[model samples]
Target: MNATVNPLLVPDPATDHILGPADARVTLIEYGDFECPSCAQAAPAVKIMRDHFGRQVRFVFRHFPLREVHPHAELAAEAAEAAGAQGKFWPFHDLLFAHQHRLGEAHLRDHAQQVGLDMARYENEMRDHVYLQRVQEQMQVADQLRVRATPSFYLNGAFVDVSFGLAHLQQAIEQALAKG
Candidate 1:
Protein backbone atom coordinates (compact mmCIF):
# COMPACT_ATOMS: atom_id res chain seq x y z
CA MET A 1 0.00 0.00 0.00
CA ASN A 2 1.21 3.47 -0.85
CA ALA A 3 1.16 5.88 2.08
CA THR A 4 0.93 9.60 1.59
CA VAL A 5 2.68 12.01 3.97
CA ASN A 6 0.46 13.94 6.31
CA PRO A 7 0.56 17.63 5.53
CA LEU A 8 1.37 18.39 9.17
CA LEU A 9 4.60 16.40 9.00
CA VAL A 10 5.99 18.48 6.15
CA PRO A 11 9.23 20.17 7.11
CA ASP A 12 9.12 23.83 8.04
CA PRO A 13 12.31 25.64 7.12
CA ALA A 14 12.18 27.36 10.47
CA THR A 15 12.36 24.19 12.58
CA ASP A 16 13.07 21.10 10.53
CA HIS A 17 16.66 20.44 9.46
CA ILE A 18 16.93 19.75 5.75
CA LEU A 19 20.14 18.06 4.68
CA GLY A 20 19.68 18.95 1.03
CA PRO A 21 17.82 21.62 -0.92
CA ALA A 22 14.35 22.08 0.52
CA ASP A 23 12.74 22.63 -2.86
CA ALA A 24 13.90 19.36 -4.37
CA ARG A 25 11.34 17.15 -6.10
CA VAL A 26 11.93 14.30 -3.66
CA THR A 27 11.51 15.03 -0.01
CA LEU A 28 12.48 12.41 2.58
CA ILE A 29 11.55 13.14 6.17
CA GLU A 30 12.91 10.98 8.97
CA TYR A 31 11.68 11.07 12.55
CA GLY A 32 14.69 9.73 14.41
CA ASP A 33 16.44 9.65 17.79
CA PHE A 34 20.10 10.54 18.06
CA GLU A 35 20.78 8.02 20.81
CA CYS A 36 19.02 5.25 18.99
CA PRO A 37 21.39 2.54 17.84
CA SER A 38 19.20 1.90 14.82
CA CYS A 39 19.27 5.55 13.92
CA ALA A 40 23.04 5.64 14.35
CA GLN A 41 23.29 2.76 11.90
CA ALA A 42 20.98 4.45 9.45
CA ALA A 43 22.88 7.77 9.43
CA PRO A 44 25.48 6.64 6.93
CA ALA A 45 22.87 5.15 4.65
CA VAL A 46 20.92 8.41 4.69
CA LYS A 47 24.09 10.20 3.69
CA ILE A 48 24.67 7.74 0.89
CA MET A 49 21.19 8.36 -0.45
CA ARG A 50 21.73 12.11 -0.28
CA ASP A 51 25.02 11.69 -2.07
CA HIS A 52 23.46 9.54 -4.77
CA PHE A 53 20.46 11.77 -5.33
CA GLY A 54 22.20 15.11 -4.84
CA ARG A 55 19.98 18.10 -5.57
CA GLN A 56 17.11 15.91 -6.68
CA VAL A 57 16.19 15.09 -3.08
CA ARG A 58 15.44 16.91 0.13
CA PHE A 59 16.15 15.07 3.38
CA VAL A 60 14.64 16.38 6.59
CA PHE A 61 15.65 15.19 10.05
CA ARG A 62 13.15 15.73 12.83
CA HIS A 63 13.52 14.92 16.53
CA PHE A 64 11.71 11.84 17.86
CA PRO A 65 13.55 11.05 21.04
CA LEU A 66 12.14 8.02 22.89
CA ARG A 67 12.63 9.18 26.41
CA GLU A 68 11.24 6.10 28.14
CA VAL A 69 13.68 3.83 26.37
CA HIS A 70 16.51 6.28 25.96
CA PRO A 71 17.01 8.67 28.82
CA HIS A 72 19.75 10.57 27.04
CA ALA A 73 17.85 10.88 23.76
CA GLU A 74 16.03 14.07 24.65
CA LEU A 75 19.22 15.74 25.81
CA ALA A 76 20.95 14.75 22.60
CA ALA A 77 18.12 16.32 20.64
CA GLU A 78 18.47 19.41 22.77
CA ALA A 79 22.17 19.48 22.09
CA ALA A 80 21.56 19.35 18.35
CA GLU A 81 18.95 22.11 18.53
CA ALA A 82 21.24 24.24 20.67
CA ALA A 83 23.97 23.83 18.10
CA GLY A 84 21.47 24.76 15.41
CA ALA A 85 21.15 28.09 17.16
CA GLN A 86 24.84 28.53 16.33
CA GLY A 87 24.41 27.24 12.74
CA LYS A 88 26.07 23.94 13.62
CA PHE A 89 23.14 21.53 13.85
CA TRP A 90 24.30 19.18 11.10
CA PRO A 91 27.76 18.77 12.53
CA PHE A 92 26.37 18.33 16.03
CA HIS A 93 23.83 15.88 14.69
CA ASP A 94 26.49 13.82 12.95
CA LEU A 95 28.62 13.84 16.06
CA LEU A 96 25.78 12.76 18.32
CA PHE A 97 25.00 9.78 16.17
CA ALA A 98 28.65 9.05 15.60
CA HIS A 99 29.20 8.96 19.33
CA GLN A 100 25.80 7.84 20.52
CA HIS A 101 27.06 5.93 23.52
CA ARG A 102 29.19 8.84 24.61
CA LEU A 103 26.21 11.15 25.22
CA GLY A 104 26.04 12.88 28.57
CA GLU A 105 26.38 16.41 29.86
CA ALA A 106 30.12 16.47 29.31
CA HIS A 107 30.01 14.60 26.00
CA LEU A 108 27.30 16.90 24.73
CA ARG A 109 29.60 19.80 25.54
CA ASP A 110 32.41 18.05 23.76
CA HIS A 111 30.15 17.65 20.74
CA ALA A 112 29.33 21.35 20.88
CA GLN A 113 33.04 22.10 20.85
CA GLN A 114 33.61 19.62 18.06
CA VAL A 115 30.96 21.35 15.99
CA GLY A 116 32.60 24.72 16.72
CA LEU A 117 29.59 26.08 18.55
CA ASP A 118 29.98 28.74 21.17
CA MET A 119 30.36 26.48 24.21
CA ALA A 120 28.99 29.08 26.59
CA ARG A 121 25.86 29.62 24.51
CA TYR A 122 25.38 25.94 23.84
CA GLU A 123 25.71 25.05 27.50
CA ASN A 124 23.23 27.73 28.51
CA GLU A 125 20.69 26.73 25.87
CA MET A 126 21.20 23.05 26.46
CA ARG A 127 20.44 23.49 30.14
CA ASP A 128 17.16 25.23 29.40
CA HIS A 129 14.11 23.99 27.52
CA VAL A 130 14.73 26.43 24.73
CA TYR A 131 14.22 23.91 21.94
CA LEU A 132 12.09 21.44 23.85
CA GLN A 133 8.88 22.86 22.45
CA ARG A 134 9.84 22.13 18.86
CA VAL A 135 11.14 18.69 19.79
CA GLN A 136 7.88 17.92 21.58
CA GLU A 137 5.95 19.06 18.51
CA GLN A 138 7.91 16.62 16.36
CA MET A 139 7.33 13.87 18.92
CA GLN A 140 3.63 14.62 18.68
CA VAL A 141 3.88 14.33 14.93
CA ALA A 142 5.35 10.86 15.38
CA ASP A 143 2.53 9.97 17.73
CA GLN A 144 -0.03 11.18 15.19
CA LEU A 145 1.58 8.95 12.61
CA ARG A 146 1.42 6.01 15.08
CA VAL A 147 5.16 5.79 14.91
CA ARG A 148 6.57 3.62 17.73
CA ALA A 149 10.21 3.56 16.79
CA THR A 150 13.13 5.49 15.48
CA PRO A 151 14.29 5.96 11.85
CA SER A 152 10.82 6.25 10.34
CA PHE A 153 10.87 7.65 6.81
CA TYR A 154 8.46 9.52 4.58
CA LEU A 155 9.36 10.07 0.94
CA ASN A 156 7.66 12.69 -1.23
CA GLY A 157 5.17 13.11 1.57
CA ALA A 158 4.42 9.41 1.73
CA PHE A 159 5.27 6.94 4.52
CA VAL A 160 7.86 4.72 2.92
CA ASP A 161 8.81 2.42 5.76
CA VAL A 162 8.66 1.94 9.52
CA SER A 163 12.39 1.27 9.64
CA PHE A 164 15.58 2.59 8.05
CA GLY A 165 17.55 0.60 5.54
CA LEU A 166 19.41 1.78 2.45
CA ALA A 167 17.72 -0.74 0.17
CA HIS A 168 14.15 0.17 1.13
CA LEU A 169 14.87 3.88 0.94
CA GLN A 170 16.67 3.54 -2.36
CA GLN A 171 13.85 1.57 -3.95
CA ALA A 172 11.17 4.00 -2.72
CA ILE A 173 13.24 7.02 -3.74
CA GLU A 174 14.01 5.47 -7.10
CA GLN A 175 10.31 4.94 -7.75
CA ALA A 176 9.53 8.49 -6.74
CA LEU A 177 12.33 9.79 -8.90
CA ALA A 178 10.99 7.88 -11.87
CA LYS A 179 7.49 9.23 -11.33
CA GLY A 180 8.76 12.75 -10.77
Candidate 2:
Protein backbone atom coordinates (compact mmCIF):
# COMPACT_ATOMS: atom_id res chain seq x y z
CA MET A 1 0.00 0.00 0.00
CA ASN A 2 2.87 2.34 -0.63
CA ALA A 3 1.73 5.68 -1.96
CA THR A 4 5.15 6.21 -3.49
CA VAL A 5 4.70 3.31 -5.89
CA ASN A 6 1.68 3.17 -8.12
CA PRO A 7 -0.60 0.17 -7.72
CA LEU A 8 -2.12 -1.44 -10.78
CA LEU A 9 -4.89 -3.93 -11.36
CA VAL A 10 -3.66 -7.48 -11.65
CA PRO A 11 -5.33 -9.51 -14.35
CA ASP A 12 -6.79 -12.55 -12.66
CA PRO A 13 -9.36 -15.05 -13.88
CA ALA A 14 -11.00 -15.45 -10.47
CA THR A 15 -12.05 -11.83 -9.94
CA ASP A 16 -11.97 -9.81 -13.13
CA HIS A 17 -15.51 -9.37 -14.55
CA ILE A 18 -14.41 -8.45 -18.04
CA LEU A 19 -17.17 -6.86 -20.14
CA GLY A 20 -15.75 -6.81 -23.62
CA PRO A 21 -13.55 -8.74 -26.02
CA ALA A 22 -10.96 -10.82 -24.22
CA ASP A 23 -8.08 -9.59 -26.34
CA ALA A 24 -8.95 -5.93 -26.32
CA ARG A 25 -5.98 -3.61 -26.54
CA VAL A 26 -7.07 -1.45 -23.60
CA THR A 27 -8.37 -2.63 -20.27
CA LEU A 28 -10.33 -0.60 -17.75
CA ILE A 29 -10.78 -1.97 -14.27
CA GLU A 30 -13.24 -0.31 -11.94
CA TYR A 31 -13.24 -0.70 -8.18
CA GLY A 32 -16.70 0.39 -7.17
CA ASP A 33 -19.52 0.04 -4.66
CA PHE A 34 -23.00 -0.84 -5.90
CA GLU A 35 -24.69 1.08 -3.08
CA CYS A 36 -22.58 4.21 -3.47
CA PRO A 37 -24.50 7.06 -5.05
CA SER A 38 -21.51 8.19 -7.01
CA CYS A 39 -21.07 4.72 -8.44
CA ALA A 40 -24.75 4.57 -9.28
CA GLN A 41 -24.55 7.94 -10.98
CA ALA A 42 -21.53 6.97 -13.00
CA ALA A 43 -22.92 3.62 -14.12
CA PRO A 44 -24.41 4.98 -17.33
CA ALA A 45 -21.25 6.89 -18.13
CA VAL A 46 -19.23 3.72 -17.71
CA LYS A 47 -21.56 2.02 -20.16
CA ILE A 48 -21.18 4.88 -22.60
CA MET A 49 -17.44 4.63 -22.36
CA ARG A 50 -17.58 0.95 -23.17
CA ASP A 51 -19.90 1.56 -26.06
CA HIS A 52 -17.72 4.32 -27.39
CA PHE A 53 -14.61 2.22 -27.24
CA GLY A 54 -16.44 -0.80 -28.72
CA ARG A 55 -14.17 -3.77 -29.31
CA GLN A 56 -10.90 -1.97 -28.66
CA VAL A 57 -11.33 -1.69 -24.88
CA ARG A 58 -12.28 -4.15 -22.19
CA PHE A 59 -13.75 -3.28 -18.80
CA VAL A 60 -13.52 -5.11 -15.50
CA PHE A 61 -15.42 -4.39 -12.28
CA ARG A 62 -14.22 -5.17 -8.79
CA HIS A 63 -16.03 -4.70 -5.53
CA PHE A 64 -14.95 -2.27 -2.81
CA PRO A 65 -18.01 -2.16 -0.61
CA LEU A 66 -17.99 0.54 2.12
CA ARG A 67 -20.04 -1.21 4.76
CA GLU A 68 -20.01 1.58 7.33
CA VAL A 69 -21.68 3.94 4.92
CA HIS A 70 -23.70 1.58 2.75
CA PRO A 71 -24.93 -1.31 4.85
CA HIS A 72 -26.13 -3.35 1.87
CA ALA A 73 -23.04 -2.69 -0.20
CA GLU A 74 -21.11 -5.74 0.95
CA LEU A 75 -24.06 -8.06 0.52
CA ALA A 76 -24.79 -6.60 -2.87
CA ALA A 77 -21.22 -7.28 -3.90
CA GLU A 78 -21.44 -10.83 -2.57
CA ALA A 79 -24.74 -11.31 -4.36
CA ALA A 80 -23.14 -10.33 -7.64
CA GLU A 81 -20.42 -12.83 -6.99
CA ALA A 82 -22.99 -15.46 -6.19
CA ALA A 83 -24.81 -14.74 -9.40
CA GLY A 84 -21.45 -15.08 -11.08
CA ALA A 85 -21.33 -18.64 -9.78
CA GLN A 86 -24.50 -19.21 -11.78
CA GLY A 87 -22.86 -17.59 -14.83
CA LYS A 88 -24.97 -14.46 -14.51
CA PHE A 89 -22.51 -11.92 -13.15
CA TRP A 90 -22.94 -9.15 -15.68
CA PRO A 91 -26.73 -9.25 -15.55
CA PHE A 92 -26.68 -9.16 -11.77
CA HIS A 93 -24.10 -6.41 -11.77
CA ASP A 94 -26.18 -4.27 -14.11
CA LEU A 95 -29.35 -5.03 -12.16
CA LEU A 96 -27.78 -3.95 -8.87
CA PHE A 97 -26.62 -0.65 -10.28
CA ALA A 98 -29.93 -0.22 -12.07
CA HIS A 99 -31.72 -0.74 -8.79
CA GLN A 100 -29.33 0.91 -6.38
CA HIS A 101 -32.22 2.53 -4.52
CA ARG A 102 -33.56 -0.90 -3.62
CA LEU A 103 -30.61 -2.96 -2.40
CA GLY A 104 -32.20 -4.77 0.50
CA GLU A 105 -31.68 -8.51 0.97
CA ALA A 106 -35.11 -9.21 -0.41
CA HIS A 107 -34.49 -6.94 -3.34
CA LEU A 108 -31.20 -8.62 -4.03
CA ARG A 109 -32.92 -11.98 -4.17
CA ASP A 110 -35.56 -10.52 -6.39
CA HIS A 111 -32.92 -9.22 -8.72
CA ALA A 112 -31.24 -12.60 -8.67
CA GLN A 113 -34.45 -14.18 -9.84
CA GLN A 114 -34.99 -11.39 -12.32
CA VAL A 115 -31.64 -12.19 -13.83
CA GLY A 116 -32.89 -15.82 -14.31
CA LEU A 117 -30.72 -17.33 -11.60
CA ASP A 118 -31.60 -20.63 -9.98
CA MET A 119 -33.48 -19.54 -6.87
CA ALA A 120 -32.51 -22.56 -4.80
CA ARG A 121 -28.85 -22.12 -5.59
CA TYR A 122 -29.03 -18.40 -5.10
CA GLU A 123 -30.61 -18.84 -1.69
CA ASN A 124 -28.11 -21.49 -0.75
CA GLU A 125 -25.20 -19.36 -1.85
CA MET A 126 -26.49 -16.39 0.10
CA ARG A 127 -27.02 -18.46 3.26
CA ASP A 128 -23.68 -20.19 2.86
CA HIS A 129 -21.90 -16.83 2.40
CA VAL A 130 -20.27 -18.09 -0.75
CA TYR A 131 -18.32 -15.72 -2.99
CA LEU A 132 -17.35 -13.57 -0.02
CA GLN A 133 -13.81 -14.73 -0.55
CA ARG A 134 -13.64 -13.19 -4.00
CA VAL A 135 -15.15 -9.94 -2.74
CA GLN A 136 -12.70 -9.83 0.17
CA GLU A 137 -9.77 -10.41 -2.14
CA GLN A 138 -10.82 -7.51 -4.34
CA MET A 139 -11.23 -5.35 -1.26
CA GLN A 140 -7.71 -6.22 -0.21
CA VAL A 141 -6.39 -5.25 -3.61
CA ALA A 142 -8.29 -1.96 -3.39
CA ASP A 143 -6.72 -1.35 0.01
CA GLN A 144 -3.27 -1.96 -1.41
CA LEU A 145 -4.10 0.40 -4.24
CA ARG A 146 -5.26 3.05 -1.74
CA VAL A 147 -8.66 3.20 -3.35
CA ARG A 148 -10.83 5.17 -0.92
CA ALA A 149 -13.60 6.22 -3.23
CA THR A 150 -16.40 4.52 -5.11
CA PRO A 151 -16.56 4.67 -8.90
CA SER A 152 -12.78 4.78 -9.15
CA PHE A 153 -11.36 3.49 -12.42
CA TYR A 154 -7.96 2.23 -13.55
CA LEU A 155 -7.40 2.31 -17.30
CA ASN A 156 -4.53 0.20 -18.62
CA GLY A 157 -3.14 -0.08 -15.05
CA ALA A 158 -3.13 3.66 -14.34
CA PHE A 159 -5.57 5.32 -11.97
CA VAL A 160 -7.99 7.51 -13.88
CA ASP A 161 -7.44 10.90 -12.26
CA VAL A 162 -9.98 12.81 -14.27
CA SER A 163 -13.09 14.87 -13.61
CA PHE A 164 -16.64 13.54 -13.55
CA GLY A 165 -19.01 12.91 -16.49
CA LEU A 166 -18.70 11.37 -19.91
CA ALA A 167 -16.33 13.82 -21.53
CA HIS A 168 -13.54 13.29 -19.04
CA LEU A 169 -13.94 9.53 -18.93
CA GLN A 170 -14.28 9.39 -22.69
CA GLN A 171 -11.12 11.42 -23.06
CA ALA A 172 -9.22 9.16 -20.68
CA ILE A 173 -10.43 6.06 -22.52
CA GLU A 174 -9.45 7.65 -25.82
CA GLN A 175 -6.03 8.45 -24.46
CA ALA A 176 -5.56 4.93 -23.17
CA LEU A 177 -6.66 3.40 -26.45
CA ALA A 178 -4.40 5.74 -28.37
CA LYS A 179 -1.45 5.14 -26.09
CA GLY A 180 -1.76 1.40 -26.42
Top TM-score hit: 1
Q: Write the per-residue lDDT of candidate 1 for residues 1-180, one digit (tens) a residue.
A: 124556766778998898778568788889899989899999988898899999999889999999999999998898889988888888888888889999888998887887788877777777777988888988998898888888888887677774545698899888888986
Off by over 4 Å in 1: 1-5, 162-164
Over 1-180, each residue of candidate 2 has an lDDT whose tens digit, in order, gives 123434447566666788777688777888899999888888888887788779898888999999899999999999999888889998898899999988999999999989999999899989989888888989999998999888888877778864456477678777767776
* Residue pairs of candidate 2 with colliding backbone atoms: none
Model 2 lDDT, residue 108, Cα: 95
Task: For each candidate in the order shown, give its overall lDDT on alpha carbons.
Answer: 0.84, 0.84
Compute the lDDT for candidate 1.
0.84
Candidate 1, residue 167: Cα displacement in angstroms equals 0.2
lDDT of 2 at 21: 78
lDDT of 2: 0.84
